[model samples]
Target: MVVRTEWRLRQQSPRFKPQRRQAVSLTSRWIIGLLTAVYLLWLLVRTVGQPDWLTQLPALVSELLRLVEIGWLATLLVLWGLVWWHERQEAGQRLPPLKLEELYNLHPADFERYVARLFRQKGYKAAVRGRSGDLGVDLVLTRQGGKRAIVQCKRYRNTIGPDIVRELYGTLIHEGVSHAFLVTTADISESARAWAQGKPMTLIDGPTLVAIARSLQLSPPSSPKAS
Candidate 1:
């Protein structure tokens, strides 16, 4: 049974928060285009009816041609410049695919984010906790049907011991979640694995983490929804 407390409720984070998108109305665009066309048609009619229209036609056409040339040249230059700048930005933002070897080089906070993202991709609603005084909890995951789980990430090269697993178990009790996850970049000690048996906790090591990553890459992920 899970214990419910005010503090535990406050500690719980949301999965994916839904955001409303702002839309532009097609009707408004159509109305504006129609108005512009009508105004241009009216001006053309008024210009053609003038008494001096025939006498001034040559000079008027020459001036209009010059303006159109200048306007088209400036517009083309601006569009070309914008395309070049956008291409440069896209080039700068492109990232290489994640490799298993690179996980060892990531910062602790980044490691936590990576774990959270992996869980999210696997169809869980996951949130990374704040860095300061999180009480050993790195991430909180809420699966379908409102089952909550806490995650702790360890980017260690050395094997994890039972002490750490015991501490996370205590945190799980405090958080009152259905389960807990401990993700590490190294193997769990034999004692640690034994200590976690029959508990509402799962341990994930380096190779397992890579396997999960590869599996997700091969299979399309289901969209994550808030529980």
Candidate 2:
């Protein structure tokens, strides 16, 4: 009987990716909006009052106003589209089916390597932190537009507790990184959720891992391993 091997080189976990934060804060947006309004109002005043400088450029003033109006509308449309896209991405965190058996068969060291690959598949500058003294960080992920986020993978057979979450969050604060995550093939305790709340920490449980693996649709290894 042929035991069809069912492992794929899967990477990219929806759990590891953060829900995009507000790229533009409200205060900055308001400040820019106010300044634009003031400038436009001043321009209108100058044109209507026909100031000496304004009188010399009657045609140019009208053309500039028309261009400004068009530009303003275009800017609004772009901003709206960006916001819509961000929201859609945030809402698209659906879990998909995965070959759980294959993932379960991975050795602990292999699991770390696999997790690193997953982040890389998602376009992160990712690497395993090495076994020697990593300060509890297993993987480090970076991107051009995002701050470095550290990851810790756990291939445990049981649920974890709040202390694990606390440790990761503490490391995030101490290192001052932008984000932190804990990925495990197990559930977390209620106290764990309590600690992770309102923090830049993510706790990815087992089922979530399966979904990310499924989404990756990875290819199996080229050859069978020696027994």
Candidate 3:
């Protein structure tokens, strides 16, 4: 018998929070302005100290000032680049924030929507059949060149066992699908993983789901909705 239980998505790290709009911090603006003033003061001090060069030729003074301006501009550019690099590195280290829909509260039918959104973003034509009468298979996605797949979305917190894998294999044969995808927010049993090793089925666990969420850039659902 096939047992069905509700599964919740794993709790996400705060670092993965997504920003809805862009806004500059007051502190950052203040720091930038302060640094600009300091650079200008330094240039003035340096120009005043070089009396010998200034007295030699008035035209050379203009050239010297131009060079100083160029140097200051280059310095600002370099600083901006460094700041950008640092922010990007932090973003890389931080986890992408997930929405309510991405969580475990999603229904089995909702799995089809998530899968379609993910695969469609990758330039594939996918259809969601989650509401169909199939117990194990939730979706049927077809790619170009006559390739078709059967997919099962398990939103269970408990580890998937060999029986589930066996059931999918049976459905794959029954449906005559070339590939099968069994995805869940929880881990799969060793036996289940082993059972899928020599088969056409692909098993995706919790970690894999996070990776997919990051790759596809799916926005987290603000409110939990029934699948």
Candidate 4:
């Protein structure tokens, strides 16, 4: 009886929200294409075989106008199809952003993957340097029109201080790169924050990182409960 009651309640519950509008089915599209082809063939036969059809206008002018209209319609349809395909390919390539809960659970290696994905979305070539002998750098990002940038991801639970920031500032020299970024899940000390001002490197704390993630159209991080 309890199981039966639960089943009844579940049946009354709302369905899962669909993420995207359903695409037209292959069969439906094929049917439409077939009908359009048949219609075009019929029009061609009528225009070619019928001598009195263009009585109001020269047959050449009527045929040319019909051809022009068909060309315009075909061009529009091709453009529309290309746009749809590009958008679908782009949507598939994007990496979903991390939630706060997920961030808190991520290992350092996974954090590097997350940051690398963000750079990828922005059209930068970014590679994780790995945990061993990374020389304090997690990601090395580069693009043709941009500077070669080094990223250090610190997924610490506690506050990261100035020492790490200074270390990353020094890391650029060792890596032979001009730009460096210190990305962390934890907040920074005021002294560290102040020290970063006017420096060559940038420090991104948790809140700022979340803002960046949102701006990139990645999944926005969920707010964590007050500690």
Which candidate, 2 or 4, has the higher TM-score? 4
* Least accurate 10 contiguous residues by lDDT in model 2: 218-227
Query: What C-alpha lDDT do the candidate models reach, one value each?
Result: 0.69, 0.65, 0.64, 0.66
* Ordered list by lDDT, greatest first: 1, 4, 2, 3
Clashes of 1: 0
lDDT by residue (tens digit), candidate 4, 1-227:
97786455434422221112222322344555675676577667767866565557887898896897687568657755865575445434645445554564554565676776666666666666756887888888775655688899988779988888788878888877767888888888998988878876888888777677667774432222221
Instruction: Give all TM-scores, in the order shown.
Output: 0.55, 0.51, 0.51, 0.54
How many angstroms is residue 53 displaced in model 4 relative to the true structure, after the best TM-score fit?
A: 79
lDDT of 1: 0.69
In angstroms, give how far residue 136 of model 2 lies from its true place: 1.0
Top lDDT hit: 1
Q: Candidate 2, after superposition: displacement of residue 208 in Å? A: 0.3
Q: After TM-score superposition, what is the CA distance of residue 206 in candidate 1 from its true location, in Å?
A: 0.8
Tens-place lDDT per residue, model 3, 70-174, is 887787777667666644443333234244346465544544455545554544445555554776777676666667887888878889999999999999999
Ranking by TM-score: 1, 4, 2, 3
